[model samples]
Target: MEIDFTNIKVIGFDADDTLWVNETYFREAEEEVGKLLSIYETPNKIDQELFKMEIKNLPTYGYGIKGFVLSMIELAIELSNGSVSNDIISKMLAIGKDMINKPIELLVGVEQVLSTLSKDYKLIVATKGDLLDQERKLENSGLLKYFHHIEVLSEKEEKNYSKLLQHLEIEPSEFLMIGNSLKSDVLPLVNMGSQAIHIPFHTTWQHEEVSHKDGHSSAFKTVKTITDVLNIIY
Candidate 1:
């Protein structure tokens, strides 16, 4: 679909997979969890239950590595009928720490995209996760200097984007969101009359996925990489 970017004054980018490697680690963790708990349930069944646990705990724990670890521990306790061993729990904790401590892996063309766009448009990060973790990532990414602001939202809904636009003191038409998820980063802004570009990541959490009908809408543009933004805007 042809999208108008002429009115966009602020560009919001989703972090995690949008900026660096994120969902990939979670996928790895899930696989590890499956192995760790395979004695209690099948790997596939454990994987399914873990997702349910995360969704159920989203309200209470929000998002990030710590929350994910807790979900794993809870599932262990449940699946093992409270007999899940301390060694298993400690291993799960190690997994979380390992994930957090891992070095940031920037996607191809992230810096070039940010560097080029920041000069012309006010760039900001509009992502949801543990505030501390996201902050640490931005600090380590060496790309923080390019952003005018960083926002860590609890959820990426229409209301959240509205508040963000109000905070930026820009109208919806002046804001353009770019991210991988159509559910979080594209559709909400499109509903608010803003523009968005979808750059699909190699990995995405199931919860961030949308139905084919909703995802096929012509309100936004989808690109192959962050570098493509340069062509779209210029």
Candidate 2:
């Protein structure tokens, strides 16, 4: 479907996989967690249980490496029948710290796209994650100057985006969201009468994946890379 962004005044970008490397580290951490708990269960089972634990803990911990690490620790104890060693717990903590400190690697053409688009649009970041970690990544990304606003949302449901657009004094018809997650970034905005472009990363969190059938009626566009955004908006 051809989307006319001619009326889009404010373009929101999702930070994690859309602009920089993020979900990749979480996959790596999950692998390490799986290996660390191999004695308690098969790697596949461990992974499954860990995902369940994450979902269960989402309400309490929200999202980010700290919450992930806590979930891992809890899973370890439960899988090990409360006999998991402190050493394993310490290793999990280290994994989370390492993830937090990973270098901010921007996706290809991110800066150029931002640089070009910022000239004609009000660019902002509308992402979900721990506020401090998201802020830190933004500071480290060196792309903060290009954005007119930065919002680290606790969630990315329709109401959240509605509130954000309202707070920014933007009309839904005048807004566009670009991101890698259909669940968090695309569908919600499309459902709210805003335009969204999905730029798929090589890897996506299972939680963020959605069936095309689920959003078949929502008007949105999908691109292969961040630079491709220029084609639609320019």
Candidate 3:
């Protein structure tokens, strides 16, 4: 489908996997945690339970590494029947720290796309995560200069996107969202009468996966990479 972006005045970009590496680290952490607790449960089982724990804690902890680490710790304690040692817990903490401290890796063509689009359309980051961590990443990414606004949303549902569009003083028709997750970046904007372009990452968290039964709109376009966006809007 040839989705037009002629009316799009403001574009929202999802950070993390959209522009940089994110889910890869989480996957790595999960594997490390699985090994750390391998005596109690198999790696597959550990991974599954950790996902469940993260989902269960989402409301209370929101998103980001802190909540994820907490979930890991909780899972460890439970798996060990409350006997998981301080040494093991410390190793888990180290894992989280390692993830946080890792250098940012921008996906190919991110800078080219952002730099090109910023010249014509208003660019903003509409990412969901802990504010401090996201802010720090933006700072580290050296791509912070491109965005007109940066929002660290707790959720990215239709209501949240509606609120963001309202706050920007622009009608939904004038806004477009580009991101890796269809569930977070594309669907919400499309549902709210906005346009969206999807750039799928190599890996996606299980939580962000959507089914065809969800019924998406014709208002969005899916592309192979971030650079494919230039081919669309031009």
Candidate 4:
């Protein structure tokens, strides 16, 4: 579908996978946690339990490395029937710390795309995660200066995007969101009458994956890479 972007004034980018490596670290941490608990259950069973724990705790912890670490601790306790050792718990903490300290590796052409688009559009970051962590990554990314605004949303539903647009004093039609998650970044904006573009990453969290039935609308476009955005907007 040929969608129009002539009226797009504000371009919003999702920070994690869209700009830099994020979910990759989470996967690595999950593997380490699974191994840590392998004495209690098989690696596959451990992975499933951890995922269930994360989903159950989503309301309480929201999202981010801190929440993930806490879930790991909780899972460890449950799996071991409270017999898990302090040393093991400490190792879980260390896994999270390592993840938090992982180097900020930007996806290809991220800086170039941001640099080019920032010149013609009011660029902003519309992402969901722990506020402090997201801010830290943004600071570390060196791409913070390109964004006119940064929003760390609690969720990325229609209401959240609506509120963000309202706060920015822009019409839904005037905003454009680009990210790797069709569920969080694309469908919600499209449903709210805003434009979006999907740039698939190598990996995606299970929670963020969406089906074709969910993204069948013509209000959004999907490109292979971030730089393809320039071809559409330019």
Candidate 5:
């Protein structure tokens, strides 16, 4: 249970789902929005349309509720031939904002494990989401003090991980990225010669899941829960 994390001076973690429950609110909102759209467009067509909009806007707007809200509004307007009322858009935006304001619920035992590991490793939270929203959630959760650094990224690409490693002045081999998504967290870090410990969440956002390629399998490992990583990594 106390194995050393070899050469790992710093440990990076993904915030959403890894530390707390986040996607459920978004999922519920997405379902509600889908229902609203279904009256005008087929469910499949709405899903496709929204996905297209997300792809177009994601690069500019990045992650979290703002981008998603904008995409929903854009799609609704488009579907309505620019006739979608501001009232409907406002209602959707309000729902998204409410989700953003919802309380942050830490996963069971996360605080205890984090407190224990903080004494040994320099912990940094390397999460990708809406910058202000993520910061607020971290602050409200009362877990910010556990981390030495907090990075709010726009995306979870290899370049993002590489940039963080550079900022920390550590080689990839000397750090580990602990997160929920195999696509975002594990593959990128593993490709960069870093280690990754995937703590699978019960549910993942649709956009967050991607097919796993075989190349990086050797460099990555998975566990049942976030706290399990502490036992295996430390």
Candidate 6:
């Protein structure tokens, strides 16, 4: 997939699975909570119960640690005979906070590629997650300087991409979206007439992965790693 970056003034990125590790930490935390909940219910039952809580809370709290904490507390209250203790909730909250505050290990060649691309393109982070969590990770990773615009969206839909392109005041064809998620980062931009590079990450959230059919080849290009991206666009 050969690309000419000279014409691309703005390069948009997905923060979580694209730039650094994210989803895996949340999965770990969820598993830890699941183990505690198993004392009250079966694993499968626990998943169903917790998922129900997630759907109910999404309206009020959105994504990231705050919603996750609320869901866990809700589950604890429901299962623990209405005697949910603050100590258990506090411990889980600390773990969730640590997941964000902890050092991020960039995927192989992520920094090197971004450093190279930033020199020639207008880099922007178009990621959707907890606002404060994403911001803190960016600040802690020390990669904040690479991006001129940091957008923390609640949803990553076609409209979000449209607004981003509009805000940047560039045509869709002139922008390129780069990230690991097909649903959030790639397809939305591709559907909007912008180019997209799909660099597959080993771990992705359940919601982010998109199924690719054989016919839709022109708009989407998948790579095994970030280093592979340099061969195409750089």
Report the number of the highest-TM-score candidate.
Answer: 1
> Between the candidate structures 3 and 4, which one is better when assessed by TM-score?
4
- The model with the greater TM-score, 1 or 3, is 1
Residue pairs of candidate 1 with colliding backbone atoms? none
Query: Which candidate do you rate higher for TM-score, 2 or 5?
Result: 2
Q: In model 2, what are the clashing residue pairs, if there are any?
A: none
Ranking according to lDDT, highest score first: 1, 3, 4, 2, 5, 6
- Determine which window of 10 residues in candidate 5 has minimal summed lDDT: 211-220
* Tens digits of lDDT, candidate 2, 1-234: 446799999999999999999999999999999899999999899989998999899999999989999999999999999999999999999999999999999999999999999999999999988999999999999999999999999899999999999999989989999999989999888878899998888898878878869645437888898999898787
Q: Give the TM-score ranking, best first.
A: 1, 4, 2, 3, 5, 6
Of 2 and 3, the candidate ahead on lDDT is 3
Question: lDDT: which is higher, 1 or 2?
Answer: 1
Per-residue error at 134 for model 6, in Å? 1.4
In candidate 3, where is summed lDDT lowest over 10 consecutive residues?
212-221
TM-score of each: 0.98, 0.97, 0.97, 0.97, 0.92, 0.90
Q: Name the weakest run of 10 consecutive residues (lDDT summed) in model 6.
A: 207-216
Report the number of the highest-lDDT candidate. 1
Q: Score candidate 3 by TM-score against the native.
A: 0.97
Better of 5 and 6 by lDDT: 5
Task: Work out candidate 4's RMSD over C-alphas.
Answer: 1.1
Clashing pairs in 3: none
Q: Which portions of model 6 show Cα errors greater than 4 Å?
A: 1-6, 212-216
Model 2 residue runs over 4 Å out of place are: 215-218
The lDDT of each candidate is 0.95, 0.92, 0.92, 0.92, 0.84, 0.80
lDDT of 3 by residue, 1-234 (tens): 446688889999999999999999999999999999999999999999999999999999999999999999999999999999999999999999999999999999999999999999999999999999999999999999999999999999999988888899999889989999988988877777889888888888999999975535466788899999999899
